[model samples]
Target: MKIFEMLIPMTWEGLKVTMSVFAITLIVSLPLAIFVALLKGSKNKYIYKFTSAYIYVMRGTPLLLQLMFIFFGFHYIPVIGYAFTRYQAIYIAFILNYTAYFTEIIRGGINTIDIGQFEATKVLGMSKSFAFTRIILPQVMKNIIPSLGNEIITLVKDTSLVYILGVTDILKAAKSVSNTYSTFTPYIFVAFVYLGIIAIMTNILSSIESKFDYYR
Candidate 1:
């Protein structure tokens, strides 16, 4: 069979797996990150310390290693052992990893907001939480767009990492065809597909950032 003939359908099938992981991770992680960030910023020493350590561990480790542990290592942990399927393991790992990253991004963004905004809120008799939700967070979101854009693009590429669990993602599918046909065409084709996704993401993020231009 010609490489393209096999590669096309296989790549499409693989893309389905990749997009499912990516879409679900973003949906769950984005909001979860916000809640975690608030915990990380808490004045209660215990709460802050625990949240900080979790974020540190997640950020400090390699995501590939994390995925392996969740899928393989979890099987050794008493009752939860062998409880999750490969797909569920990947989802857990991806969501946990991205939530840590997005939390840190949000923290950095809140730091970048002008302190005077906080003072102004105080003058207006606003609670800190009220100010954060109604005022500060909106600007923090704008400030974090560039970082989020980069992370999101990285997520698209990282979807390929699911193959570590023997999940048939785009790169894995492409590899199967390449090995059979003895041609690099499958790899090149998937590279174009990846680039196309990143390009669309960049454009979407650019539009989102522009919408916040009035913040300045």
Candidate 2:
């Protein structure tokens, strides 16, 4: 019972850290991903190839290695090395890694869109931008919501990876308590905390997905 009592505060602190990484990554990565997807889809072959290579590298590598490299390797760089804190390094890695993923998700969504819709918009004398914004994006978003939600949920769990940089995230907090008390209960408590977070997110995402059902 006393361990449970101790678990509460520690878990709360860790939850704050986890949520911070998740929120910042999601908020920043989504828009940046849209831009990347556009670049990858560009008519200019060089732009498309460059963006494709970037996405390929980011997706091919493990995120943990990416985080480690950003945290440790950046110090070797001349000008930019000194500017990064561990938190900044983690955020940067998360943003870049997830942006690559989201770019693909967005691209897949865009591809799933029927070419006929574009033609219909062209017939209506709408500009490409107007057609995309008005007709294409909504349907793409609807198609992509399920995939995006899964990524968001995965990110919540992935935030624990920040512990590699000694960020004292939720799992790290639990580990600390487990080590001090010589009890495994902290691990179990932290697992439930993670599940609770996932549950809440799943609920929210489901609500958002339901809102898009009108598209069907």
Candidate 3:
């Protein structure tokens, strides 16, 4: 087989890892974001204070630092004793980082709904939770889709950071292939892989936006 044909399976394998991270991040982060948004929006001072500090620490620090800290830092802990593997560490790090960002986006989305809407919901005998599900969340998601698209694209590229913990994702696969072939072809192919993933995501998000435009 030609070198390009050989690259097909390796590149496909790497792409799977990258997509897995993206899927896991979204699945875990979306609901966590809603809870975090509620915490930040709560009337209780302690709840708000705790969430504020949590967001502050998460946003103020670098994701790479957080990842390294958990991945390697856990190894030094007396109890856990290196039970977590690199892929697990990377997944956890990305999930935490994405959840924080998603919370902010959701908060903004929720705020975009006019207070009059809530008042109207109350007048119509809707409970806060019911109104949020029936009216608020739909509108919030519409507003947040653009931001979500950006975050998802960033996640695609950010999976490369997994290499720091020795996870052989698409970018790392490219490196391995490059080292073996002594050429830049592998890296070029990996770029296309990333590009393809982003392009497909962009199209999917764009379609969602278009479908939701009627609600705007």
What lDDT would each prediction earn against the true structure? Answer: 0.92, 0.91, 0.87
The TM-score between candidate 1 and the true structure equals 0.95
Best by lDDT: 1
- Candidate 1, 136-159: lDDT as tens digits: 998999999999989999999999
Rank by lDDT, descending?
Answer: 1, 2, 3
lDDT of 2 at 194: 88
Off by over 4 Å in 3: 78-82
**Whole-model lDDT, candidate 1?**
0.92
Those runs of model 1 whose alpha carbons end farther than 4 Å from true positions after fitting are none
* TM-score for each predicted model, relative to the true structure: 0.95, 0.95, 0.93
RMSD of 2: 1.3
